[model samples]
Target: MHLAMIGVGYVGLVSGACFAEAGQTVICMDVDPQKIEGLRRGEIPIYEPGLEDFVRRNVAAGRLSFTTDLNDAVDRSQVIFICVGTPSREDGSADLHYVDEVARGIGRTMDAYKVIVNKSTVPVGTARRVRRLVSKELARRGLDLEFDVVSNPEFLREGSALHDFMQPDRTVVGVESAKARQLMAELYRYWTEKKFPLYFMDVASAEMTKYAANAFLATKITFMNEIANLCALSGANIDQVRVGIGSDSRIGDRFLFPGLGYGGSCFPKDVKALIYMGKTMGYNFNILEATNLVNQAQRHRFIFTIGSFFDHQLDGKTLALWGLAFKPNTDDIREAPALTVMERLLDLGADLRVYDPVAMLEVQKHYENYPYPERIVYAPTPEAALEGADALVINTEWDVFRQFDVSRLKNLLKAPVVFDGRNIYDPAQMKQAGIHYFYIGKPIY
Candidate 1:
């Protein structure tokens, strides 16, 4: 299978690498000349677990190649996958300006019958819009060529993108033609050797599935956060409650982590986009509406807890903050709860020393815009982040943080007070270290 993947961003690169690893010949194209050159030099732009090795091995095997010439990629491949970004607009709808540009370029450059796969997470009816635009472009060029647009929504969780792509829950292909379905199946047959099923559906349903998956996960996280908040006032332990509820078989313990909140490229934007899409058709999505509200409130409430813990006198206090990315194993910090906490703490006049395993440069890029750069320090290690700090706050639940030596931590900080936003540590163990531990949904000790 010869496939041309447009846009070498997160989705495009991951899909291209995985497809090449599956023994398909893949040509990944990007408009950014610098990014394409980086790829040509075997340099991956994003920090995804297992991706650097995956790209290296495939490129070594001569199965994967990179280019900036979109026309060449389009002309050479039978299938062109549009894997561009659809960032959220100010109005909460998906901003499709990039997608529209790519669609027009593909229309102008497409030579023969090609299957254009919408691999990006897009709104409903975008396939039809692409189809109409492509037809108009072809008509403008006075050429009549057949092309099939397929909506192939991605359900990849960051930090576990390689696994998600290799062993997908299921492959949803929204196609209108039998020929297109057959071509897509041939391209993806290697994945089915492990028995991952392929689901063929209508275009609209396929687009809806991506939003529905992310929105449901966001709702789950927000629901747990709400329960955690209620437990805090009632003097209850959310860990025990989470276990009790999870054992019911109806409720799962996957996204039920009483963390700061959900973030990254998917949940926050997709949920809002779904709400905006529904509102356009005069449909009110009460569930997702409440979900978004609760999620945002959780971040602020966590910040308030830290302030109230210190009697609201956060001035001149140096706080040790761990975890910059929304979750872990990825450097993406979009809408991360840790950043929200950092901002609020700074506003209240507290200096911050932060560390993440991989998100250092990302956090620095954002924090550089702040007026007081001296107030924030990027530590080289987790222990360095704790030095000279009044209290330690854990935001992202990375596995390494959970396994830190508690007794040594007691000896390192200015004070023995620890605020755990992810509830990663055992309160009993923290107490044994002569540290006052505060976690979500537990009695503040």
Candidate 2:
């Protein structure tokens, strides 16, 4: 199959590479010339784990390519995957201009029958909207070309996107016609042959599935955080509660970990988008609304706990912050709880020495326009971040942070105080090491 992936961002790039690795000829198209040129030279734009190697390997094998010209990609490919970003607007609705532009370009450039797949996370009616835009463009060009707009949303996690793409639990495809269904089945035959489930549904259902899945996961995380907070007040251990409930077969545990709430590219944006979507339909997603409020409050609550420790006086405190990328194994800081903590702490007049494996550069860029960028120092290592700091604040729960030498941490910090937002450390262990440890869902030790 010849595939053209429009908009070579995270989803587009990962999907295109994975499809190419599956033996399809994939040409990834993007508007940015520099990004396309970088891909040509084996330089990947995003910091997804194993993505660069996957892209480079596929390019070396001649199964993958990059192009800045959309027309060429559309003309040469039999399958056009609209994988552009549907960024959330201030109104919480998905901004679909990029998807619209790609659909119009495809309508203008496609010369024969093509299977146009919507792989981007969009609203329920977006697939139909794309179909109408394509039809309108074809009418303007006075060409009666047949094309099928299929909704095939991606469910790839950021850190383990390659694995998720290749080994999805199930694939949901929304097709309008039997022909479109057959084409999509053929495209995913590799996975289907291996018994990976491929579910076919209506376009609207498929679109709603993505939003529903993300919103539910966000709600689950928020619910867990709420439970953790209540546990803290009632002297209950969230870990024991989590294990107790997680062992239930009916409520299989995932996303039940108590943390600084859910923050990443998908959950927060999708939850907000779902809320806005409900409002547009004259329906209220009360649980989701509360979920959003709770998620945001979770971050503030952690910040307040930190402030209360200092008697609300945080002026001139040097703190060591570990972890910056929303989660570990990726450099994506969008909507990260760490950023919220850093900004709030800085507002409280504290100096921070932060360190992350790969997200330091991204955080530095994020703080470029801040009023006082010099207040936050990017440390070279975790130990360096702890040097002369009054307390240690754990944000991202990277594996390196878990393997830290507790004695060394106690020795390095000016004060043996630790605020663990991710609950990565054990309270008993901290107490044994003679370190003051404060974590989520437990009494401070």
Candidate 3:
């Protein structure tokens, strides 16, 4: 199969690489010449685990290519994938300008019968909207061309995107015609070899599935956070509670660990988009609204815990912080809880020495123009981050932070104190090391 993936961002590039690896000829198209040129020169823009290797291997095999000319790709391919971004707007609805532009471009460029696939996260009616836009363009050209618009949303995690793409839980495809369905089946026949379930539904249902999945996961995380907070106030340990509850077959142990909060490109935006979708339908999604509120408050409460430990004298203190990306293994920092903690601590006039395995350069570039850039210090190593610091704060539960030797803290820090946001450390182990430890949903020790 020959396919053109429009907008070579995270979704497009990863999907294209996977398809090429699966023996399909894929052309990844983007509007930015610089990005396309960089890809052609084997420069990957984002930091996704195993992505660079996959891209390089496939590109060398001649199954993958990069281009800026959408017309050329459309003319050569039998399938066109709209893999553009749908960022949230101020009104909480998705800003579909990029999707709209790509749809119009496809309509104008496609020369033959093509399967138009919506691989981006979009609203329910976006498939029909893309169909209409393409039809209008064909009408303008006085060319009667048969085409099918299919909704095939992506369900990928940032850190393990390659794994998720290769081994998906399920593949949901929305289609209206047998022609479109057959083409989709052929395109994804490789997955069925592994016996991964493939579901085909109506366009609206498929679009709703993506939003519902993200919103539900976000709700689960928020619910656990709320339980963690209650456990803290009632002198109960949340770790025990989480294990007890998660052992139930009905409630599995996923997203149950208490942490700062949910972040990244999907959860926050999808929850808001669903809430707004309910409002437009004359219904109130109060649970999701509460979920959003709880997620935002968790971070603030974590900062409060750190401040209360110091008797509110955080000014002029040097705090060693770990984790900058929203989650580990990916450098995506959008709405990262670690950044929220850093902002609050900086606002309280505390100097920060931060370290992350992959996101330090991203954070440095993002905050380079800030008014108090000098207040933020980038550490080359976790131990370096703890050097001369009053305390250590762990935000993201990266493997390096999880496996750190607690006894070494006594030699590196001015005081052996720790604030664990992700609950990565053992309270008893810290106590044995004579280090003061504070974590969510547990009494300080």
Candidate 4:
């Protein structure tokens, strides 16, 4: 398969690399020349586990390449994947201008039959919109080109993107024509041969599936957070509740762990986009609305608990903060709870020493224009962040943070007090270690 992944962002870069590794000839195109040059020089823009090695190996094998010229990519590929970002607009709908631009470019440059796949997570009916845009552009050029638009939404997690791509639970492809369907099947024959499910449906359903999956997961996390908050108020343990309920065959444990709430590039944006879509169709997603409100409140609730512990006197406090990325194993900080916590703490006149394995540089860039950038010191290591700090705060549940020695943590902190947002540590263990511990949805130990 000759694949052209337009937009070498997180989705495009990962997908292109994976396809190349699967023996497909892939050309990843980006509008940014600097990014294209960097990729050509073996510089990966985003951090995903095993992505750099995967890209490098494929590039070395001459199966993968990068370019800034969309025309070149369009001309050389049989399957063109629109893997651009569908960022959330002010109205909470997806901004599809990038997708539109790519569609127009493809129509202008494509002289033969091509399978144009929507690999980006977009709203329902975007495939038809892309088809219309392409037809309009081709008509203006006085050129009649035969092409098919297919919706093949990607269901990838940030930290485990490569694994998700290679070992997908099920691949959903929405196609309108028989030709497009056969081409998609042939493209994913590697996974299909391994007995991984490849589902074919209408384009709208495929688009809806992506949004529905993310929204439901977001709602599940929000529900758990809600239950955790109630457990705390009612003198019950959320951990016990989680296990008891998770063991039920109907409610298998996944996204059951409660924390500062769900925050990532996909969940927050997808949920909002779904809600907006509902409004547009004269329908109301009441549960999703509550989920959004509760998720945001969960972060503030954690921050408020911290403030109350200090009797609202957070001034002059030096806090040790762990985790800057939204989740573990990825350097993406979009909508991360750590950002909310840090901003609120800074507003309250508290200085923070923060550390994440690979996200410190991102955090530094994030705070470049902030009023109190100096107050948020980027620590070299987790232990270094804890040294001489008033207390430790865990935001993201990275594996390294989970393996910290209790005695060492106690000795390094000015006070042996810890506020665990991710509930990484057991309450009994913290109690036995003689450390004052606060965590979500549980009695303070």
Candidate 5:
């Protein structure tokens, strides 16, 4: 199959690489010539695990290419995948301008029958809207071309996107016509050998499925966070509560760990979009509203815990921050809880020395234009962050931080104080090391 991926973002790049690896000829199109040129020169724009290897391998095999010319890409492909971004608008609605532009471009350029697949996470009626835009463009050209728009949302996790794409548990495809369904099935026939299930549903349901799944996962994380907070007040341990509750067949152990609230690209945006969707329809999604509230409050509660430890006297404190990425194994810092903590600490006039495996450059770039960029110091190593600092705060649960020498940690810091946001360390070990440890959902010692 010949495929044209409209936008070269995370979803488009990963999907295009995986599809090319599956023996499909793919051209990943983007508006930025610089990004396309960078891809051509083996320079990947994003830091995703295993993505650079995939792009380079497929490009070397002549199965995948990158381009800024949308018309050329559209004219040569039988399947056009709308993999553009739908960032949240101010009102929490999905900003579909990019998707609409791609649809209009496809309608204007596609000379033959093509299968248009919506692989981006979008609102329920976006496929219908894209169909109308494409039809309108075709009418303007006075050309009657047949194209089928299929809603096929992706469910790839960020850190493990390549594996998820290559080994998806299930694929949900929404189609209106039998022809579209058959074409989609043929496109996904490669997965049938792996015995991965394919679900066929209406377009609206498929769109709703993506939002519902993320919202539910976000809700689960929020619920666990609430329970963790309550456990802290009642002198209970969340680790035990999590194990006891997750052992139930009904409640699995995924996304149940108590940590800083859910962030990154999908969860925060999808939850807000769903809430906004409900408001638009004259319905109130009360649970989701609370979920959003709880997630936001989790960050503040963590900040307050840190502040209370110092008796609200944070001025001139040199703190060692362990992580900056929203989660481990990726360099994405969007809506990262670490940033919230860093900002609040800076506001309280504390000097920060931060370290992350791969996200330091990103955070430094972000602070370049800040008012007090000099207040934020970059550390060469995690141990370097602890040097000459008053205390340590573990913001992200990176593997290196998880298995660090606790005894050395107690020796390195000016004060043997630790604030663990991700609850990565064992409390008993901290106690044995004679280190002051504070973590989420348990007694502080």
Candidate 6:
């Protein structure tokens, strides 16, 4: 199968490369000339685990390629995946300018029968709009070329994108025509063979399903964070409560880990977009509203923990930060809680020493405006971050940070105080090491 992927962003790149690795010839198209040139040379722009190896291997095998010509991609491939970004506007609506532009571009360039798949998460009814655009453009060219629009949203998590792509829990296909379904089934033959059910539904439900899944997960995290806060005040432990409640098969634990909060490209934007869409229909989403409130409060609460630890005299406190990215094993900083912690601590007059496995350079790009790089240090290692620090605050749960030597941490820091935002270690262990530890849903010890 010859496949064309428009927009070589995170999803497009990973999906296109992985498809090529699965024996399909893939041509990735992008508007940016520099990005296309880099891809031609096998230079990946994003930092994802195992992605570079996947891209390099497929490119070496001649199954994958890159280009900037949209018409050529349209002419060569029978299936096209639209995997562009849909960032949120200030009013919390998903800004579909990029997706719209690509749809229009596809309408103009498409030559023959092709399955135009929506691989990016978009608001409902986008597939109809895409179908209209392509139809209008084909009419304009006076070529009655047939094309079918399908919704095939991705469920790839950032850290484990390759794994998720290879072993998806399920594959969704939204199509109005049996022809589109057959083409999609043929494309996903690899997954279908392994019994990953391909759900065929109308376009609207498929679009709504992606937003619903992400928003629900975000709500779960927000609810747990709120419960964790109440637990801290009521002399209860969230970890224990989480385990006890999660024992139920219905409430099985997955995203229930209480922490600074849920932050990434998907959850925050999708929640707001859903609420915004509801408002456009004159409905207020009360549950989503509360979820947003609780998530915001969780960040401030974590900051308060750090402030209370220092008795609000965080002024001139040299704090060591263990993680920079929102989560571990990826360099993505979009909506990261660590950035919120950094800003609040800086405003309160604390200096920061930060370290992460992969997000240091990404953080530096945004924090280049810091007037005190002298005060805000970027450590090469976790121990280097603790050099002469007042205390240690854990943000992302990198494997090394989770298993750091307690004695070394005590010897390196000026104080043995730790604000464990992720609750990675047991309170008993921190207590046994003679370290002052403050964690979510648990009292300071």
Tens-digit lDDT track of model 1 for 4-81: 999998899999999999999899999899998998898889899999999999999998999989899998899999
Question: Which residues of candidate 4, in runs, are more than 4 Å off?
Answer: none
Give the winner by lDDT: 1 or 2: 2
lDDT of 5 by residue, 1-445 (tens): 8999999988999999999998899999999999999999999888889999999999999999999999999988988999988889998888899999999999888899998999999988989999999999999999988889999999998888899999998999999999999988888899977798999999999999999999999999999999999899888899999999999889998888998888888899999999999999998999999999999999999988888888879888899999999999888898889999999999888899999999999999888898977788899999999998989998899999998989898789999999899999899999999998988897542
Question: Model 4, range 80-149, lDDT digits (tens) per residue?
Answer: 9999988899988998999999998998888899999999999998999999999998999898888999
Report the poorest 10 consecutive residues by lDDT, candidate 2: 436-445
Scored by lDDT, model 6 comes in at 0.89
lDDT of each: 0.91, 0.92, 0.93, 0.93, 0.92, 0.89
What lDDT score goes with residue 244 in model 6? Answer: 93
Candidate 4: RMSD to truth: 1.0
Residue lDDT tens for model 6, 1-445: 9999999988999999889978899999999999999988878888888999999999999889999998888889999999999888999998888888888888888777899999998988789888888888878888788788999998888989989998888888889899988888898898889887888899889998999899999999888888888888888888889999889899988888999998888889999999998898899999998898889889898899789878988887899998888888889999999999998898899988999999999999989988877768999999899988999999999999888878667889999999988999888988888898888888533
Candidate 6 worst ten-residue window by lDDT: 436-445
TM-score of model 6 vs. true structure: 0.97
Off by over 4 Å in 1: none
Q: What is candidate 3's lDDT per residue for 1-445, written digit by digit as tens?
A: 9999999988999999999999999999999999999999999999999999999999999999999998999998999999998989998899889988988888887879999999999988999999999989988998889999999999989989999999999999999999999999998999988898899999999999999999999999999999998888888889999999999989999989999989998899999999999999998999999999999999999999998888888888999999999999999898899999998999887899999999998899889887988789999999999988999999999999889998898889889999999999888999998898888887543
List ranges where model 2 is wrong by over 4 Å: none
- What C-alpha lDDT does candidate 1 achieve relative to the native structure? 0.91
Tens-place lDDT digits, model 2, residues 1-445: 9999999988999999999989999999999999999999999888998998899899999999999999999988989999988888998888899999999988888789999999999999998899999999999999988889999999999889999999999999999999999989999999999899999999999999999998988898899999999999988899999999999988778888898998988898899899999999999999999999999999999999899999878898999999999999899999999999999999898999999999999999988998887788899999999999999999998999999888787789999999999998888889999998888897432
* Model 1 lowest lDDT segment of ten: 436-445
TM-score, every prediction: 0.98, 0.98, 0.98, 0.99, 0.98, 0.97
* Superior candidate under lDDT, 2 versus 6: 2
lDDT of 5: 0.92
- Count of residue pairs whose backbone atoms collide, per candidate: 0, 0, 0, 0, 0, 0
